[model samples]
Target: MYTKKNYTIKRMLSWTRRYIFMFILLSTIPVVLYEVLDWKWLHLPWLPIGLVGTALAFIIGFKNNASYGRLWEARKIYGGIVNASRLLATMVNDFITNEYALKDRTDAEFFEIKKSMIMRHVAWMTALRHTLRVKKPWETTTNNKSDQEVMKKLHIQEYAFTLEEELKDYLSKEEKQAVLSKTNKQTAVLNLQSKAIKELKLDGLIDDFRHVEFKNMIGELFTLQGKAERIKNFPYPRQFATLNLFFAWIFVALLPFGLMSEFEKIGETLNGSNHTGILFQFISENFVWLTIPFSVVISWIFFTMERIGDVSENPFEGIANDVPITTISRGIEIDIREMIGDDKNEIPKPHPEYEHTQM
Candidate 1:
């Protein structure tokens, strides 16, 4: 996700520059008509516009809260995955031993077993993150032209490589084929893990108690996977999202109309005064043009708030503002591999951040 304390105003403007231009154009129309064309009847009352603004603000606030809730929930689910993965690595390192084995093996053999299990778990994480990064019909962050431009600067690891390519490093040829063949690659990888654990139990490398514990941990991983899937599959209520957009645009369209009259009234009041200097009179008489900037700023605020909610609604769309699943998964892989004492060179390094953002 965006790791910086805040986005620079320049960057924000760059991302929304097209819309800002539209707002400027929208604001300038009524001022030109009322001032140059002398169409005084074109201006709207401020009271009704104020009421619409209030209603739009409430809806935007509500949508932001709900969108943040989904993002936070996705983060919590990945946090659980990180903990469970570490626990599984610790269990593999400590529980499987010669003390309980039906047939004793060499130190190299035991190490191989531990390494295989750990690597398989990493493969499962890779499969899961790849699944989450797949596009859903409702996800729009990457579809926007502005968002697409910003994404070019951020390196999203999941999109950089295919699932099969990454899995090759962690899975055997037969296992990788099995995983890729399945419709649900993550579920297939997990099933392979369970089978391997079961075989270890039968060989007495893992005792009965440890076997059950391993099964329980796998179940927890499944639960976490399902939780992430739920958020990925379901979207924030579209009806609310649709209406929120419509309302925000309606308020923006009406804003300048109301503002033109308010500024004109101030200009009229100054024109009637005799005490004001020439400079003050000049400024006051043209004050209605100030409506353009005021309207642009006000419209930009409402539209930006609406855009924030829209982008945040899906946390797994592989955008800069997502939950950083690729980074999290890579971290888990590194931590678990180190725990099992795999070759330092063989263990992959953490995914690097790009433009102060981790994917």
Candidate 2:
């Protein structure tokens, strides 16, 4: 999500502001203490810190892999839902065609209804997509007006109000409550669509084979919807992730002290201002500021990987680089509408500004 080269440092600093402070504070304590005591030997501990880096690497590697698995699994479930929706809708259209052959309506009337159902299926795809993304279904005024007309054509007047105020007022409290209920509102819409097919069967609008096929398609859609919800709800475990992360920072923080003994011995044994002093300096260079940088730089890599893994583990959250669920759902809706032979020129296009640079 943040591939912009110029903003990379800014984004990283923002993500790890607290950790950056801790790393500095933790590293600075030793340096300040050494200066206070005037003990040059204290600097040798940092060499031991270098050992923790190796163990920290393995911990971060394991956690990053676990996080990627969650991200990848969420994406796969979404892809499955898209394919299932398409396949189910296609089956409905095919079945409806067979049912139409045995219907009493005129050929032209049958043709119109067939086209209508196909187009309506496309609208369902769009609705499902928006629901998953938690976006308002009515993005444009034109879309609302179009959907109103669509409902009217389909004779689903209960769902075609010009405004919320247009809803019925002549009702008891319970009746008003029924109108306000979320489950009833959605079920009403689904029932209308499903009822149309049921009526078609009764009126010989479609044959038994076609009706059965359409019912099967809807069943599959129901199954796929459940599957998507399951994947989103049941996330990966947090305990293993938390344990691994704690150990990584702990290892890096404590590693320098153990390597201090060797350097202190070298400093004590070697003569001052002798050939051995130059020899000691040569080895000491690898154990001083040089080693600190080595340790911090190594920790930075693990920290960066850990941060990336954290973002990916929750696919539904608005983190950068998660599944583009909103985009995918919108595209599916538009495609389904086109397939159903609805408004050819009014197909919705994906927003260019969906991906924000200022997250």
Candidate 3:
């Protein structure tokens, strides 16, 4: 996500420049035609255009609100994962003991068990993030060409390594193969985690209460996983998205036509005998053409807002505005491994930022 407090003007311009260029071209067409050809019929009344703009504003507002809700919800879900992961690591360290075991186990064996479970949890995170980053046909980040180019420059997280490569560090060869073979790798990882904990309970390494607590923690992970999957699999309703674009464009198209007449009136008033300065009079006389830039600016606002909503609606898409799942996953891996007493060198560093955004 954009970790910086505010987007720099340079960065904002980089994103919006293409849209601004398109708007300028779109607005210039009618103004050039009207001024050169004297096509008085090209202009539309400002009142009706203002009403359309008002309605379009409301529609865009609704879409942006919905998009923000999705983005914030995804962040909260991952935040829960962060907290639960720490709790899970702490519980694993504390709960497993020889006091409850049917057979006497050494401290080394207990350490190994804690290590295994923690590594498995890391594998689960790897699987979950990889699943979320899988490209959906509807996701703008993957579907848009220019967006893909920008993402390449920023070096998105999922692209840094294949899921299998990352999982190899956390899972045994057989377990990795089993997970890769599954249709839903994340769910499989969680199931393996549950079975492992149950085996611990059966062997009396952990008490019954601890076993239940372990299962409950796994269940919470399941819920969080389901929440993330829901956002990834389900897209915003296409009807609303499609129509919002259409209406916004409609307003943009009619905007210059309406503004041209108002500008021409100003031009006429200035061209009359009331104007004394030649420079001011000439500028005002040519003000009708100024509608192009004015319209371009206004239309740019609407188009950029719509585009922002489109990109924000899918928070797991590995775009600049996405939830930074890869960073979060790596952070959890570091935290959990450290909590379980893994060597400092064995723990991977947290994902770093590029262009002020953590991917």
Candidate 4:
């Protein structure tokens, strides 16, 4: 997600330049036809266009609100994951102990077990993020040329490496193969975690109570993962998205025509006034031409609002404004590794930001 407080005007304009040009073209055509070609009859009524604008405003507002809800929910789910991961690390360190062991292992052996469980949890997170990053049919943000350009500008860690490559560092060859063989790799990893905790219980590293607690924690992680998947799998309603776009464009197309007549009337009034200065008179005589910029600005606002909802609808799509799952996952890994006293050199660093955007 964008780390800065706001996007620079230059970047915003650059991202929407093509659409701005289209808005200008859409605005200019009606003005040219009405004023230059004497097609005065082509102008639309102000009341009808105003009603459309009002309705369009409500539609855009609703869509943006819904999209923001989805984005925030996804972020919250990851926030839960972060907390659960840290808790798991704490539990692994404190719960698994020689106090109840049938056969005690050395401190180094215990540390290795803790490290293995923690690293496997990290691998689970890696798999989850990779699964979310996989493009869905409804996720068309990357398909746009302008959006593709924006994506290239940011450094998305998930795109830089494959899940298999990342898993190598955290999982044993056997465990990695087992997890990778499943269609739902994250689920497989979590199942492995559950089995390990059960074995610890059976082997007396942890008692029945601690084992139950571990199971509950694993269940919570599974719940969080399911929430994230729900948002990723089921998109904002397509009918709403499609109709919103159509209505916004329809209003944009008719706006210039409606403004033409109103501006012309103002110009006529200026020309008829006896006390007006030359500048006012000149402006009045050519006031209808001002419709071009006004129309462009108004249309740009609607288009930009619509675009915001579109991008926000899928927060996992690796767009510049999306939730930074990759960064968050890496952070969880770092925090938990530190919790277990793993060597700093062994723990991977946090993912880097690019152009003030993290993904």
For candidate 1, the lDDT comes to 0.89
Question: What TM-score fits each model?
Answer: 0.96, 0.65, 0.95, 0.96
Relative to the true structure, how large is the alpha-carbon lDDT of every model? 0.89, 0.53, 0.88, 0.91
Clash pairs, model 1 backbone: none
Per-residue accuracy of model 2 over 59-148 as CA lDDT, tens digit each: 677777877786777777768767865775565445554435453566566556765555444444433433343322221112333222
Model 4: CA > 4 A from native: 1-7, 275-278, 354-359
Tell me which residue pairs clash in candidate 3.
none
Q: For model 1, how does the per-residue alpha-carbon lDDT over 1-359 read when each residue is reduced to its tens digit?
A: 55444455567778788889999999999899999999999988899999999999999999999999999999999999999999999999999898888899898999999998888988999999889988887887546888777777778777898998998888999999999999999899999999999999999898889999999998999999999999999999999999998998899899999999999999899888885698898888899999999999999999888888888899998777788888888889889889988899987788776443322
lDDT of 3 by residue, 212-288 (tens): 99999999999999999999999999899999999998998899999999999988887875758979877987889
Q: By lDDT, highest first, what's the ranking?
A: 4, 1, 3, 2
Clashes of 3: 0
lDDT (C-alpha) at residue 33 in model 3: 91
- Residue pairs with backbone atoms closer than 3 Å in model 4 (clashes): none
Worst 10-residue lDDT window for candidate 3 reads 350-359
* Model 1 segments more than 4 A misplaced: 1-7, 355-359
Q: How far is candidate 3 from the true structure (C-alpha RMSD, Å)?
A: 2.6
Q: Which RMSD values do the candidates have, in order?
A: 2.5, 10.6, 2.6, 2.5
